[model samples]
Target: MTGTPGTRTGRVRVLIVDDEPALTEVLSVAVTEAGWHPYPAADGQSALRVARGCAPHAVVLDGMLPDLDGIQVLRRLRYENPELPVLMLTARDALEYRIDGLANGADDYVTKPFSLEEVVLRLRGLLRRSGAERTRADDPVRVLGPLVLTARTREVHRDGAPVTLTAKEFDLLSLLMEHPRQVLSKAQILDHVWSSSFDGGGNLVEVYISSLRRKLDRGRAPMIHTVRGLGYAIRPVEDGR
Candidate 1:
């Protein structure tokens, strides 16, 4: 697979690791469709080599590798690139497998028989959360009172103090700040932030919102307001009217 510059977004390189050639080929196509370049590897060693060479923004790693187990590979990869987002793909559905993968530093995990569309969305979410996806240099820095967000720098400050956030938290807060006082539905948030259409059967969005409030709203009037049965919004402390 060759790296092609994206028409709309910057080129994002993704390493697809799987022993099955057929799966690798299909994943390469999916990666391309998702507007990313794919670097395919059949074994753990090959995966390491490709990762170092391509400097992929993310990786989809198979759990059961022919050369090394997924956990080992994940640890090795983390050592090489601690911030690189990795999504583990495996047939194992056991709770222990999931726990082990997460413990080893996988950014996300998916079982076999998963939807290709879902996989693409997960990859997109990972990229967004890790600040790997490029944005326009001219994007404006949003400011609502003391809260400040510079999209280009991926920096957020509250009351002139630097506030650190994970990739996902930063994206979620940015979306809310972009549309202050406007209630954004769960579907809208998931679509814009996670890049997924997964039904709101999960509380992932809510969890992130809660953490954002804790971090960004602490020692100040809450800006993140949850509209019951509607969604959430960021607004000034006064003038609920």
Candidate 2:
């Protein structure tokens, strides 16, 4: 959807790659309401065709297609526009698949049966951040332990190595890192990372947090913490704990 009166200058264009006509229509309507232009592609080939022609700011891609897989689509897009932001949609819930998506250069992934609002929110955030960096060229990088976030590049690094994070995980990490050692409630996280129309019973945030812990906290100094009966925080691990 478009922002406010003064925020409507250039429209954010999105190319959706999915074989489901019904889902694509629904997404198109939602994206239109959110002030974005939506281009639909029913298969991987069509997706690439549309993407090449439109050169969208972002893409919403499905994992499965009749001809080519989502990974192939991602590969082509990377070849054509390496820096293009992609939001992959898949029904697979397996951790391995999610990891594979990241490994293959997907900017973000949303499982099937998702809320339209969540999708729109993610698109907006990605587009906003993408453009925001150009306007704030002198912003300093944010660091937390091994993690390094560059607002200019919209890139994250862990120990000098590039790390891929979904939109939600990046948002959550940014929030926690902004207030290190401070507890943030689930409600707060929801409000910050998701649109108000999100209605997943808070499970969505938990799922993404688990994903982040696996990717960002494994074998590390345990920066992300859970406060019982309260909320969550990210801080350096105590010497003994």
Candidate 3:
């Protein structure tokens, strides 16, 4: 769908990949009601084909499918379009399963029986953040200690060099930097970075945090820290050593 310039006028394009026909129809109607164009796919192969042709802004993927699994679909999508955001849906609640999905490139995953309003809200948030990033293509780079995130090029740098980050990692870091020194709850992080469809019981956020720490804290002092039972925050190391 076409969007008007300088105004939030266009419908966000969304691809719904689910084997259940009933679920797909319900989701399509919900997405349309939420101001997005929903494209339905009943299997992995069809999803891939539609993704290639539609180039949707984001995808809502179900874990179970007839042919290829959701994680596999996510991997292939990442290979084809690294920046494409995806919200995974599954009935599985196991931590290992959640980690596997995230490792395979899913930005977020929602458990079965999720509310339609929740899903639509999450999609809108993800689309809003994505749209904002596109609009800031000419803005100055944001520096946080040894870390540098360029809004213009969608690039992240460490010290004086470049660093490659998955789409979700960058989004997480961006959200943290935007609220530096302020602790943010896992739910807030998921809503801002992965979309509201996330439902992995905070494990998804933990895994991404671990990945970010490895990349952003290799040689430098740690900046990302967990606040005990509260949440997480990013700031300069306080020891002053």
Candidate 4:
């Protein structure tokens, strides 16, 4: 299950970390069924070793490990690959744990009594996002309403005024504007904007959307609209439809 990055050529390498052998087997089966290559590790140290050697695109990490706590393992993984998308699976059902996981750079979190289907979906979303970002790297510019994004220059302007954004913020805005008026599901936004390798469970997406609204729609008619239970969309707000 271990191979050089890109050596396999058509599938994404995913590191599945869990101390439970049965669960690990089930997850490996699911991952394989979903067309991803799964590399399983039974402990934190082994997880890091596998990750470093193979360079997986994403990781499915269990919260409790025999050697190192899941969070600590995640920290070490992040250090090795800062941008690696990690999904935390834990038996702990606490708000603080989820918050702490997200703060420490986990892209997604799932409780132990979770759906295998959901994990598959999340992983697919992450891969698609990462692929789309790579394919769309050369797309130069996109404009929506009065907002404009120039990918080559890495610049943004709203209503003819310069607007500064962090690199990630700009990428998020670019994705939204690229498909104006279309209601992008949280998964879609997460995949396209955040590189699909990380989910962060919509919180990261929400935070970025809020920041975009504040900076890009200030004193304006509000182009960013939350679609209530769906996701977010960016388009001109009609004056009095």
Candidate 5:
């Protein structure tokens, strides 16, 4: 899953730099699975060149590079993009080795032979803490089965038919569509879709949900379902499992 060099609009960008092709591929795959684009570079020069254009939201930098040292690369990266989140991958687990990477500029350090999932989680945590995801460009249009929603336009379509909605309706539908097949509780929906100072009860969510159901399921099988007293979830019409 190699990505072209440069910043990707409306997508979270992750740069994976490792001299080993196998390791770089593994990291890139994991990063892609996390729902972000992965840009792979094999050496320090390549990483810097890619970063110059990639403007990566986060970086997974290996401790050893064939050309420049990992710390040196990290230094150059920080110099350019000071706020870029970096997780250094070191083959050595020694205290001094770990300290050196962190002391320079690494936001975090991961030892080699590390769990692939751990590296992804570390990168996610770094992004969250750094507030990068929140500042990312508008979400690209999201598609799920016959349902399609465009964030930039705030428009939703069902079965190729347009559906008009209020501001609140659009927000609620967008949230559900963001996590299709995942149940979101009334409280959760209220917090995300409505204002925090919104004193309205869960009934507000129920009303909006009812409106969405009427608009989306008027002539189709129920795509939105309620899990007893749990919460509401949206799925593709044919995705019954």
Candidate 6:
């Protein structure tokens, strides 16, 4: 985790650094599911680059890297922002490894193959301690790539053009925006947007989703996507694949 002025964008940004591509993506998705922006880097150099641009509130750092070691990265990050919270992830659970990470400035430690839920909870705790936690419900504006929505005004925009949506459509779209990049099952969508577990809720979700796609993606790159049996997710077109 590191900070330099002029990088924050009114959202909690987390930096996830790991040499493994799959692990980095998983961590990024988990952070997004928590309603926070995630910046993923596959190596220490890449991590430093991202931190320079995002001013992340917290970091999930892998203990080993292809280039610099995790402890070295930790030192550089601390030099930039001593208050930034870091959750270390190490494949080696040896006592010395744990002590080294903590002595280097890690706020928390988690061994690899750890529970995703536990990592998220630990990050949340670190954020709370650093005065970086904020309720997503309190943010009236939601942004996903080129799409923007203002909850207070009930306004939706795609590339600066006003988009018209009905009450249910707005509710569903906002729910997706609230958890960008996170796949939401029909059951979850039903409970959150329709406030029901009725048998028809699944069909209702599909119908509204279709309508949203038609209206929001008329002549442009699609943002709303279906994930087959899993349900649906909305992401920038480039990343949807």
Per-residue lDDT tens digits of candidate 4, residues 1-241?
3211221222466789998888888898888787666778899988887665444678999989999999999999888778788889999989999999999989888997988999999887776766622443343645454455666787776544678899888888878776767889989988776666684757888899899989988898788888899999887555211
In the range 1-241, model 3's lDDT, one tens digit per residue, is: 1111111222355789998988998898888777666767889998887665445678999998999989889999899988888888999989898899988888777888899988887777776767733543333445454455665567776543567899989889888877767899998998888776867849999999999999888777888889988899987554232
Compute each candidate's TM-score over C-alphas: 0.54, 0.51, 0.51, 0.52, 0.56, 0.55
Q: How do the candidates rank by lDDT, highest first?
A: 6, 5, 1, 4, 3, 2
User: lDDT for model 5, on a 0 to 1 scale?
Assistant: 0.81
Candidate 6 vs. true structure, TM-score: 0.55
Between prediction 4 and prediction 5, which has the larger lDDT? Answer: 5
Which ranges in model 4 have alpha carbons more than 4 Å from their true place? Answer: 1-7, 132-241
Model 5 agreement with the true structure over 110-213: per-residue lDDT tens digits:
89789999998899999999887786665465556556666777777664467899999999988887788899988889889886567774888888899999
Give the top-scoring candidate (lDDT). 6
TM-score quality measure for candidate 2? 0.51
Error of 4 at 157 (Å): 47
User: What are the per-model numbers of colliding residue pairs?
Assistant: 1, 4, 1, 4, 0, 0
- Poorest stretch of ten by lDDT in candidate 1: 1-10
- Model 1: lDDT equals 0.80
Q: Give the TM-score of candidate 5.
A: 0.56
Q: Rank the candidates by TM-score, best first.
A: 5, 6, 1, 4, 2, 3
Location of the lowest summed lDDT over 10 successive residues in candidate 5:
1-10
- Flag clash pairs in model 6: none
Error of 3 at 53 (Å): 0.8
**Model 1 misplaced regions, further than 4 Å:** 1-10, 135-241
Consecutive 10-residue window with the lowest summed lDDT within model 3: 1-10
